[model samples]
Structure formats: structure tokens, C-alpha cells
Target: MSKVSLPRHVHRVVSRGREYFYYQERRGTLHAGERIRLPNDPQTPEFWNAVRQAQGTFGPTPTDTIGALIDAFEVSWATRQRKISKGTQEHYRRYLKPARKAWGDLPARELRPRHVDALIRKIGADKPGAANNILDALKAMVSWANGPVELLTHDPTQGVERFSKGEGHRPWTSQQLAFAEQVFTGTIRRFFFLSRYTGQRISDVVRLSPNDVDDGGFSLPQKKTGVKPWCPIFPELEAEMVTWERRPGPYLLQSSGKSAGKPFSTNQMWKAFDRERKKYSVLSGAVPHGLRANAVIRLRGEGYTALQISDMVGMSVEMVESYSRHADRKASGQAVLREFQERDASQIVKRLESGKRK
Candidate 1:
């Protein structure tokens, strides 16, 4: 291959007769020692786009600014410590994109609670969920910068508050579940059954395969919490699984389209689920995460304690109780009524015996 002239800051090296390009900042620059690999062919648009992005990201960011702090924090969070999960990192990046654009040039020390409050209000005006997500991302970044990184002296998000997210993802009622059973079939039904029975988040549910199943139950480490729990196969779920045709990859694969044979992404699964859910007015309020609550409620109704349910579902006992609040209340009411009836019957028997003796 002939030598192709590369752009400034872009270097090319030959290894085993193959060429690879990399973007490395010049010495004594604001972002010195920063290196990012570029695409092989400089003639393609992808190569230029990658170069542009690398330059913008690893370029000369102003010192002591929010952008610089965020850039450093992201590098440390992603590369050094790597405590954050990939899914969570992607989630934080979604919110951080807008924040970076809005306050990138702002001095890190100048950030205040008032500024955060204003940003939340503006973002929350239309989308409270988005505002809350952004607030959380900001809080995490600020906390990291304040604590270990020592980029900021004081916390700007100390008094900052997130927008109120109303009662999120209401649990599916028995009637709704029955309706769903009648309406959804095949892949969609499998998705529903896995989510409802396993009580796993959609992220985990979509990735489940037949191999994950054993004599005991589904064995997998949860993506978000990193808890590996053996989710026992319920009778209902077991019956449903018997009907499913086992596939190579994920149990739930994309049936059709260009992505067929590939596992369904979380967003794709949500859209598919929502489409089926919206067809029936009865399931209008039901969401995917609500199935987790349904599992908790079902377990509680089956006489499982919160601790037991927590162990089974890889959730905290507090969270299990939170999800099964209505079930707990009903169980408590039933127990009280039973105790009262037993006491009344015992008193009546004692009175009859006393009357006979008199």
C-alpha cells in the first residue's frame, strides 16, 4: 500500500505490514498524552468523523472549566476505576451531552445550587423524567469531582433538587395480566412471561437464554446491581417455557427485519411491548418495569416474606416491601380478621360450657 498523507496530530504506524492510525495530542498541550485510535482508511468519511470527534473531545479544553472537569472525570470513571457499569455509563452520557453543551465553558467553581435549580426547571418544564436523569448525572459527576478527583472544593449540587417523578410504572393488575395473556403471543408473550416471572429488569430479561436455565432456575448476574441470584422457575413460567422453541443466542431474538437473529435491544423490546400494551385500553398504564412489582406482589401473596422475596429477586428487602405494599396490607388485614374470628369462637365455646355447668 502507498503511503497516505495524514492530518495534523494524526499519526500512522505499520505493524505486520498493516497500517493503523492514531490521534495523539502534541507535547505541552492542554490535553497532552491523550491518544485515540482512528479508522484505517483516511480516504473514508468515518476516519475524518472519528478524527473530528477525538479532536473535539481530547482537544484543548479550557482549564478549571466544567468541560475539562467532565472530560477528566469521564476518563477516570471509564478507564481508571471503572466502577460504573456500561449501561449506566451510557445513561449518564445521554444526560451529560446536554449539560456539557449548556455549561461546558462555565467555571467549575462558579457552579451553584441556583444554577442547577434553574437547569432542572428548564429541562423539567416538558420532561420531568429527563430533568431528573440529568440532575442525577450532574450529582454523580459533582460528587466524584468533589471526593476522589478533588477538582472542586465545594459541592454545587448540595441544595439542588430533582424534579418530581410521579408514581412511576404502576404494577399490572391481575385483570391486566389476564388481558395481556389473551392479547400477546409468541415473542411478545415470552418477553412478558420472563419479565413477570423472573422479576428481573428488562436489561437482564432480554439477555436470558435457555442455557441460563437449569433444574433450579435462571442463573445470571444482574446487569445493574451485579447480584447473581438463582431465580426459581415458577410453575406458570415453567409451563410457558416448555412451549418455547429454544434458540442459539438470547431466548428472545428479533423475529424479523434486518436485525433478525440478533437479540432485542432494551429500547426495541420497550417499543414492541408498548405497541402491544397500547392496543388495549386496560393496559394503558402498565409498563415493563411494573412486571417486577407484579412478581413481588405475587410472591407476597404466596406467603413469602419480604426477606425471602428479596433473596429470590436480587432486590433489597426494603424494595420488595415497597413493591408489595398493597399485598402486605391485604395480608395484614386478613390475618387480623382471622385472629378476631378465632377469639370470638373460643369465647362462645367457653360461655356454652359455663351455662351447662350452671
Candidate 2:
């Protein structure tokens, strides 16, 4: 077999918005360009179509330099991740869309620090956490692209700023839970109770089926972490799920139609929760995921060990500490801490009377 001669090294670069570096060999001539304008996303199909039209214009399978490819990677990454949840995906797309418009055609080796900084700054402005998320995903994409062609010697994200945790995890009181119970019905009620109990993410729980309940407990494969989340079910929840299962439906809530169907979208599920929350008139701005934090706070007050809580909730120990600062008390329906403490002031009055007698 004859070996194909390796093509001359086309210059590679990391992508900087509006610019990047590139090296080219044309008819035995070598040249370099930085931050060359390529097609933005709006111009992508046309640009690539032009590439196909100009296929042999450069050479076979002519591709953008490393800098440009990184932008391509971000676009693909953003699109795929968006399918994870409509609203969540939209948040990522908001950044990647403009980013692709800015850096879509540069070579990989041309990417610059400022380009990364600009994108991060943009996302961090309105949504700080999303900024960090996109940054991390881009770092992985660059790492993969760099290794294939050695375009970059160092990772751009090493110095990127991450989002802060903000005061603490969002918490919901037991009274909030009671109101939610009143508001949501049928499978949704079951789903809400389970969220409060297991702290499994709504994204994770909405897909659950009766078969997931097995061997005296339920096992769920967490979407984000890809770990088996097996926990003993509450006797009441288990019974409720059984009754719900006897009725015709593939999901505990809504996703597919009849036995065969598409899964419930994350946005749809959340919208439903909002409708119910409004109907009950309990609290505003309380999201489904906050139930996880509420459960952690509740269990912590009950004096449950963080390790034990983590086991039940299918979260990592670090995540457990990050969520629960304390043990074994329910946060779902408790009165406000300030009010509850004030209600107990009679103890201090009794001690004062004893001192007066002495």
C-alpha cells in the first residue's frame, strides 16, 4: 500500500473574537494571518457552502485553522447542550450565537485571551452562573481541539472568573411545601413530594417510571452526574406511585402521549409548576429545583448527618456540605426562623421568674 504524503502544516491558532492567527501553504508559498474574518453563524451555511464550492480552492477537506474550529466547537456544544433543557439551553445559546458571529471563521491557534474575556464578561453581566458554565464547556472543547493539532500550549480558561454561590442555596419552608401540595395534583403532587423528599432534580425526576421503583427503593440515573441514584422510597410515596402507575401513562407526570411519546420538556414542566404555584398563591419565584435545597435545610434541622443526607439525596459529599450547613429538621413547612424563635420566648420568661425568687 502506498502511503499518502502528509500535507504541509497549515498554520493553527486559538480563536479571538473578530480575529485569530493562521498559517497557510499556497503553491509552495507560506504565509500567516491573524484574526481573519470568517462567516458568522448567520453566514455559516453560506460560508461552508462556499467552502464546498471552493473545495479544491485550498485543498481536500480544507478546514478552518485551530482558532476557527474552536468557535465551531462552541456552536455545536451550545446546540447540543440546549437540547438538555429549552430555557437552560437558550441561556447558553444567547452567548454562543454572538460568539460564533464574532469568531466563527478564525483558526484555532489565533484565539486570544481577550476574546475569552469578552465572551465571559458578556455572559456574566446578565447571568453570572451561565458565564461560568460556558467558560468551562469551552475549556473542554479547546483542550480537545488543541491536542489534535497542538494549536495551543496553555488553556485559556485557567484564569477565567467563576460565578459566586450568592448568599446560600435557595430554601423553601414546610409551609411552602404544604401550599405546593395543595396547588399541584395527581402525578404532579407525587412528583413534588418526591422532589422534597429525595431532592432529586426535577429534570431527573420527570422521566421516572414505575419500573424505576424496585427492591424496596427507587434507582434513578442522574442526568447531570450520570450516577445511579438508588434510595429507599417512602412507604407512602411508594404506594402513591403504585396507584398512579395503575392508571394509563408512561411518565409519572406529562411527557409522552399514552404509552409511546416524547419526554416532557424542562421548560414545560417548570411552566406547569409556576401555574400551580400561582393558583395556590403561596410564594413567588420559588422554582422546582429549590426543593432540593429546601430538603437539605429541612433534614439538617432534624439533626441528620450530612453523609446520611447525601446518601438519601444522591448528591456528593462536597455538594452536601455546599447545600446543607446543618441536620434532621424539615424545611418544607417550618415557620420563619425569626418567628419560631420569638414564639419560644416563654422559656426566657420562666428563667427570669426563678432568678427573682432567689
Candidate 3:
């Protein structure tokens, strides 16, 4: 039953199957909220352009449909996937899943700042870290949706402070590291050693090879950033990693002839790493990712600066900001300062004694 009815507004976006419907009201056109149907045929990309065009013409988009906004966000996200990494794409997808309205559609032009704030608050109540992750993703959507509007304009997630640190990385203790090293060998060693050395993501480590490791240094592109770059290996791990062969197909670390040739799925490698990590001590608390943080900790303790560590580990200063945030960093800092201060005091006392003797 296709009944011609004007619920409200000058233009209406009805997403029924492929054809989108929109009403038009222009200069020398009818009154405010006069019904006009614009083309939404998928064949004509102008249909999308027309909708984008309409916003510039109007003062404020009428209290638009919330359902329509959610759909628009999905479309914008798909467009962005062309330029970003797969990891980022998956992250945005997770955020978009919860952003759907109760009716399964949200209009872009109708969202208010309060709506975003409330969503952030609700997510925060559920889990603080997740709340921030979702907020970042939601903000990307808000930015796209704000292209139009004359007045009553407010961007959501604006002025909304993001969540700060909670707990820090749970790196393995020296004993745990020793114990794991003693018990593990072969392919497991390759995986474990790379984690200890390169501070690479598990996905990157498993895919690493002799070609990636050269002259006691390993270099590869980050799967997450899609950046092709190289990072040096820890001297201790480098000696072993440099000898491995680069396979034509998948992994650097191999189990046997068959599984060795193909790459391990992310989940598969995670499960395998978990088994190895748990074997030493439950207290090690080192996940596949925790190993990367541990490497950073070791590097910093050995007098590496943030920039040096970022370059060596193939991360941005911003992304590796988490690395500098260990609870022990402050404690470690104080200890180093105290040691130097005591050394200075001792030297001063020695000079005074020598002067008195003279």
C-alpha cells in the first residue's frame, strides 16, 4: 500500500530497499516543509550528491530521521575503509554495531550533542576503556554527519574528555622470562623470542622472516598502520632470528613442513601463545601483546628515549604512549635519579677530603 503522505519536513529520506526518497523545497518553491521527492536510485550517484547538495541550500535541516543518520554513518565508514588498515576497519565496525538506533536507523542531520554525551556516559558505565574506544569511533561518524547545517549546530563528542590511564601493562618478571626461555624451544622460541626482542604484534611476528631480519636487524611493515618500515632486533634475539629462512608463502616460525608453509590465523597464534605464556607462571600475565610492552620496558631501562623506542618498534609516539605509562616507570625513574644523586654526593665528599689534606 503506497500511500502518498507528508509526515513532516520539506524533504523526507525514506530508505525502502534501494530507492531513497527525499522531498525538495527551494527558492521560489512552495512553503517551508513543502513535500518534494528527490531521486534515490542507486544507479545515479547524483542521488547521493543531491542529498549532500540539499543541506547547503537549507538553513537548518529539519529535525531529520535518526535511522537515516546511522545508515549514512555506515556508508561513510565503508568509504573510509579504502584508505585505512584492516585492523582499523574491524575496530570501526565494532563501534558501529552498537550505534544503531532502536529502530535500526539514525538520521545524520538530527543528532544532538546530548545524544552523543549520553551514549558516551552509558558506555563509560559499562566499561571505561571500551567507552573511550567507542567514543573515538562515534566521533568519526559525527564529523561526517556535520557537513551541513546553518544554525543549532553542535558536534557531539566535542569537549568530552577521553578516559585516562587505569592499569598498566603486566610484563613478565626476569624469573618468568628465564623460566620460559629454559622450557621453550624451536618455533615457540621464535614466537617468544620475537616478542621479547622486537616488541611486535603477534600478527607481525608470526609473519616475520629471514628477509625481514638482516644484519642482526629486522624490518617490516606494520599490519595495523599499513606502513612499510623496518625495526632493529634486540642483539640477544637478533643472533638467532637472522638465521631463519624466508618462505614463499606465510610464516617465519614453522611447526612442521605443512603448517609451516602457511600463516597461522590470528586466533590460532593467540591460542598457541597463551599456552606458552601460561606454562611458565600464571603471574607472568604476559599476553601476546604484553611481550611488546615488555620489550619497550627493557629498551627504556637500557637508556632508550621515546623517539628511539618508537622508531625501533615501528610505532608512533602517540600509539606507543601506552609504553611509557608503566607503573614501574615512575619508580624506575626515582631509583635512577637517587643512584646518580648519591654518586654526586660521594664525589663531592671525596673532593672535600682531598682539599683538607692539601
Tens digits of per-residue lDDT for model 1, 1-358: 4444466888887899898999887845886867888878664435655776787855543567776676655545434443666667777878888777888789889988888888888989999999999889888888878886578898877877777656566789889999888888988999999999999999999999978886769988888767777899999999988998865789898888899888988889999888887788998788999999999889899889988888889898978877788777888999999999999998889988889633
Off by over 4 Å in 2: 1-62, 65-98, 148-151, 242-263, 302-308, 326-357
lDDT of 3 by residue, 204-257 (tens): 887776667566577787777676545766567757656656456444444655
Residue pairs in candidate 1 whose N, alpha carbon or C atoms collide under 3 angstroms: none
> RMSD in angstroms, candidate 2?
11.5
Which candidate model has the greater TM-score, 2 or 3?
3
Q: Which sections of candidate 1 miss by over 4 Å?
A: 1-61, 124-129, 162-166, 337-358
Best by lDDT: 1
Which is the winner by lDDT between candidate 1 and candidate 2?
A: 1
- Tens digits of lDDT, candidate 2, 225-272: 566766667665666566554644335546445733445656667776
Each model's lDDT comes to 0.82, 0.60, 0.63
